[model samples]
Target: MTTDDPATDRTDREDFPDWLRQLERDIRPGPAVRLRIWCRRRSRRLMGAVGVLLVLALVAGAAAYGSGHLRRPGPAAHPAAGPAATASPTAAPGPFAGTPAAGWPAGAAGIVLPAAHRTGDFSTAQVSAGLAQVRAALLTARLDRAFMAGRSPDPLLRHFAPAARASVRKEYATETIATYATRLAPDARLAPDPPRVSGRITYQATRDNDGARKLAVTTNFVWVYGFRDPGARSGYSVVLLHDTVVWHLPYPDDVAAASRGLWLHRTSSYGWGLDCGTIHQGLVRPGGLDPAAAPFPEDPEALYDPDHPIAVPTHC
Candidate 1:
């Protein structure tokens, strides 16, 4: 439908792009929330695109809570006083709430990033599902090894909308396995392997969004990189057992889909985010943590230590 179509205007579709662009510039992590954390640095333009899409998803979700097929509920007579009188009570979902999608990440408890209060106007499930889509998109960004090898980040990037796809593709076009390997070892190189990941993500659904539930999702991941440990002190040391940080990545065997599988974003947008509570044993030293041995140029803070920071989820 053209911008002239009334139906298009109803969903704010015509205005969504403008609204989205503004939100991207303004969105920030709430209390104890992490923002702009990516493990490996990536193209800012690509990440900006990803951020826009993520927030847009949340913006759309705010409406998902309407009780009747996007229908707003009628007002109640003589509403109760105080919190009890509010349209959304903690105990009761509001007229417009949503449900979580199937197989989305859950159970990573007490990790909610504190921020503006939500009026129970939405279904916790639906908000989570919306967040899951973002996570799926992130997972695709992290796990789809094809992108790093100068291949299409499909199936992985598929989670993203069409517009997002265009942005990611451009970034991939500029990358190559040799570029990363060269960065890791200028003289003595380290072989690259798929990075493994695990962690909890939390959300803060905000009061903004003009009756929609614009929200932000925070990710805390533990990544373990595997490589052909070239037992050389000059390069990455075999300190953790084989010149690499010996840690187990979090791809669960039961997870059947590549989209949901645990992995880190190669670019420094999503995969690198960490908070105090997420450190874990076998996790590489933060000072030394970077993508594709990209940290090689910098001095490592510490080698892989089993006793190093092991992330513990913060929100109870």
Candidate 2:
């Protein structure tokens, strides 16, 4: 069906080229790791093209692309006031009021663990201990004020084994710090309200190619930040980061004590509502506030749903 609206037709022609370019540049192809990522992107793009209105919707609402399915709260209806009636109480809206994150727990409280159970070689008690350490490291990396402000990530690095810590430190200098922790760009400022978070932690007993016993703790979490302007009452610009990290705990009997602590095994991440230019600088810059750098459009479920498959080629 062709639209009588010339404006809509013009928009489709203008936006498709840039959107396709941004998507291609952001996804790097690799033989072993990026094949799946490339396919997923292809499929999604095809579907969007087939549904013309969907592509238009995505382009029109680009600023909110990764901010989760934009769920603006409906206006509240008030009962007619009378001397015979009493006022009802209602909780005020929160920082995430219009996003999917509105109902998620605030900050670290959202990073919850399940009841520990035996797995492979690890007993219930061992699993609990390993998960606790992983949780602490996550809090330090993502929510620590200094770390997020681009300060040294030593606090997070220290949680890894000595050798792993050294490796991570090197990666940080090369601007790979965002893979290990969420850091704000030099120009960005978070709102007074703490970030909203939601996700899960799971663990399993596993072995490496060397056949050494280890406990693997995996965390998949999404953090949503609302940026504050100098004197604004509230921030409309939001940054959403989804990170998947696997922490490895070497068996005490399999290695020296120095190597027995938690080590970073693997990690991947993707973000929405960010200035992509700053992503290469290893910092998150909320984009909605900048007219020239509006956030890139992405599938809301792909970012907000923890059970969704982790995005690959995690460059931006």
Candidate 3:
């Protein structure tokens, strides 16, 4: 059976092994059906990866939304300031008919506030004008002898909000300002140079009664008073006065509307000290007398006067 029949013997030997031929057949794609089957196997893994990414993206979006980073452009917040209680929307073309100051908005516990509005960035242009108005008011209140000689201090009342006008009126009635006024007699006058910004002041957000966002501003007034002390041993007494005046400004959304809502906000409970400074007794007299050294509260700029205190008595 193992004879020398070359052709038959070669076929029996098999040049390509059975296993190698079968491997080639398996490697080659047979049809579209087989290719579809192969793709379906990997598609599950690919789909699972996409699904995981989608879940992560959804989570991130939810977090951003909760944190207010992804807030949508929605209707603006409408805050009903105290005036709304008295104001009738039907009476006016708008909610607040004439102007914001018509009734003068109030906050909780009768805290006087500007009209209900947004807060501001307080740029130089916006803040400078406000600064000027307040500065002039401050000068008139504590200084300006000629203006207050016999005239009513009511002129200064225009600058203060209606709610606080009475309280501050009492403050000017006290003897502190009176004493300061008399000391600068014989053509002595108190002069205020332009106000210069002193130091760091914080800007914090607040919610108005109507839920409108507002900004609280901390401001320092470095008031330098130039006076002629005709009676003093020294020639001229320059008083370096400092006080922290706090107010609020409305936030502006549009560039055109910037600072339109800007104003000062103050409540007796939340306002800063009217006078907080290193007491320099006399400008001409260096290392001058200390106001605290006086047996009585003798500081001219003190909020409380020893001889004449607030209408409602407060222990100094």
Candidate 4:
């Protein structure tokens, strides 16, 4: 027993030294040092994450600011602040401005030619007198060379306004009367009778700024010519032609209905033919010619009537 006791005591003492050394090492702070190192590493990682989040927040704020500025309202947002709020400029009165007085018609028809055959202020008889002067002028040109030698002496020529006179002068000056006569057949010559004429004249009665009456007339004529050239071996030849004349008078309504009638029907294309009838139906209506009345017919085969010869000399 004594021998075994001694062996056990020695073994126990040896084990105790190793165990004490291990305990001392554990309590010395090595565990605490490892834990402190781990905490420092984790703190650095968290700080890095916070820094990234702050950078993202700054970028997002800049984008939002730019977007807001771009969406601002423009000048059109307030209409009252725009050009619409300004007053519009007015236009000046025209030459023919102002409403006509009471009882005056709306257009020229009422102001120029009120009645079917009457003009402004002038009686039908007075208009006829003026028109007779025009017819005389036309007839004189055919019958007498002296009348055609210079400007027409008829009072009707004086009635024309300056513009109308200029126009007539220009037209007549440029016209080749010699050429026109030469185009006729060698046997052609002036007829013995005057041309039969018919038609209407339209006149304008406008007052100028100085209160002077101004007149503008349009005449249409249907002329029938009976050729009486002695050289014609085929007997008497007849032809028809049309003419239109426009003139101005110093006074209003100084044109006659008969003259106007003669002017309108004077042109061969518009006189005593189907075309003339068509024009009459269209032009002479409620305000023009009597629609109920029949138009004069034209015989396609007949050249002229023995009783009603209307031809005049063309050459001097």
Candidate 5:
């Protein structure tokens, strides 16, 4: 007792407060050990919460990426809905608009002319009216005076080649009905009773050449002049001339070889009328002549000297 042993005395000491003693007894090892265990439990709970938040963030990111990829235009894409979806304005009317009359003339099938013909056989009255209209249109600018006068005017001058229009205008200051007649080659006649006033005209036209191929075509036209009044004078005349113009279809080889020199001729009540005459000639290249030309005037009044040949290219 007189000599205290430090280790044993410390272990057996009871000098601390009752609360401290109780606390020490409550902890299994020491206060520091208890603090370390509490801290580890808290750290595990915090880590679990952080993991849950990270998982939620990843899921949200994936959904956002998928949504953007699906919503992303090109040829394969559907066309946008707009005014372009409507039908074109120039489409032809239905078949009900005009039907061929029953019991059409012999050699005439429906409103269309048949292929092949006898020597005496010629175009029907319907076809003739169409030709007349075409002639008048071609001669419009060239026969203003003749139109004003009461004479049957030449129709070619009005519908000359678009290129020749300027030249004709320059040469013939004022187109006269007499000038129109002058341009004709003498033998031409109007078909007595042209086809009916309404409906399309179709015909099988063959070329003048022996080996020429025939073709079928339908044409529609508007006539600016009507049947002239025998007694009345001074009125704007108008009529509807619709018919088919069937002409021989040139063979591919002939068309290729002949270039612009090919043309078709027809005999009319008035005179010999040449068609496809105004076509330009030259190589098939830039600045070349067009293969389809205007009809040449055979009337003496409208004729150009062959020897001197009008400056206009009349190769055909």
Candidate 6:
């Protein structure tokens, strides 16, 4: 049962215990058993690969959805119920919404005065006072409801120097009042809301041809009026008036009391959306509202822009 020689000491099948030998023989796999084992390993690896592919597909789908490349089906649209269900394709915008005056301040508020500062030889206080007087004049000429309604123009003329007031009044009576103030036509009625105003006022000290020192104040403004037009496209018609008024303030002691106040120096104005046929009457009549009104050429963009030089009014 034992050997002492080194070569003979090697283990043999006989050295295995009975139980171990029996177990080895009983557990030996045949062809079918080997095949089953191979199939199980292959199936596990295939399942793992399939799971990886499924995860990849889910990630790709999520990315596509985030990028807006994937669109999901939505519920079908239902038909509208009423005969007027369809909306107007080219309907006009709401009152003033489509025009440049949409954001402008209403009434006299839009005549913005520049901060008073010493310019040339004028003092800060004098500049401030001059600006105030100019503001009052603008409000009376453009925004005064009574004046626009065809009242006496004395209120506006009162602001002018006594010597200049007579000439201005003479012009007011003989020439079209349209140049000096907005006067509505006998048949025209403005909307209850105040007219919209926009523009700026500036002042500087300058000399006349005779070298007399004077503070020159200039105002550039656009006044937009909405007249009641129930039959018009937007339920109202628009009239745009642009005016530039210049006033000269002489030193207190330079002249007599009667000529001491602000003097109307020069003025230029242009208006759009007025009936050319009746405008010569010195009253405002909205053009588009009347079928018989004559149509004149105008650049609407230029009308709304304050910096654009006034275009000569076209007469039909």
Estimate every model's Cα lDDT from 0 to 1: 0.34, 0.76, 0.41, 0.39, 0.33, 0.76
- The candidate, 4 or 5, that scores higher on lDDT is 4
Off by over 4 Å in 3: 1-136, 142-151, 175-204, 208-213, 231-234, 249-316
Q: Any idea how many clashes model 5 has? A: 35
* Tens-digit lDDT string for candidate 3 (1-316): 2368899656543543566458756674354744465456569888999999999999999998887854666677888665435654563122112222123221111121223223354455545544455555545644444544434657666665455466555655443333222112223344332211222244456666765555565544333343444554443344433344466545455213434433445422110111222112111111244355434334443421112222222112
How many collisions per candidate?
28, 0, 8, 25, 35, 0
Best by TM-score: 6
Worst 10 residues of 5 by lDDT: 278-287
All candidates: CA RMSD (Å): 44.8, 40.2, 26.3, 26.0, 20.5, 11.3
Task: For each candidate, give its TM-score against the true structure.
Answer: 0.32, 0.64, 0.33, 0.31, 0.23, 0.65
Count of backbone collisions within predicted model 3: 8
Look at candidate 3 and give me any clashing residue pairs. Answer: 79-210, 80-210, 118-250, 118-251, 119-250, 119-251, 120-251, 248-265
Ten contiguous residues minimizing lDDT sum, candidate 6: 8-17
Q: How high is the lDDT of residue 224 in model 3?
A: 36
Put down candidate 4 lDDT per residue, 88-129, tens digits, no spaces. Answer: 778633211221111222221211222334566545765665
TM-score of 3: 0.33
Tens digits of lDDT, candidate 2, 34-82: 4454556478786767799877788778867645445765578798886
What are the runs in model 6 whose C-alpha is more than 4 Å off? 1-95, 174-176, 289-298, 313-316
Best of the two (1, 2) by TM-score: 2
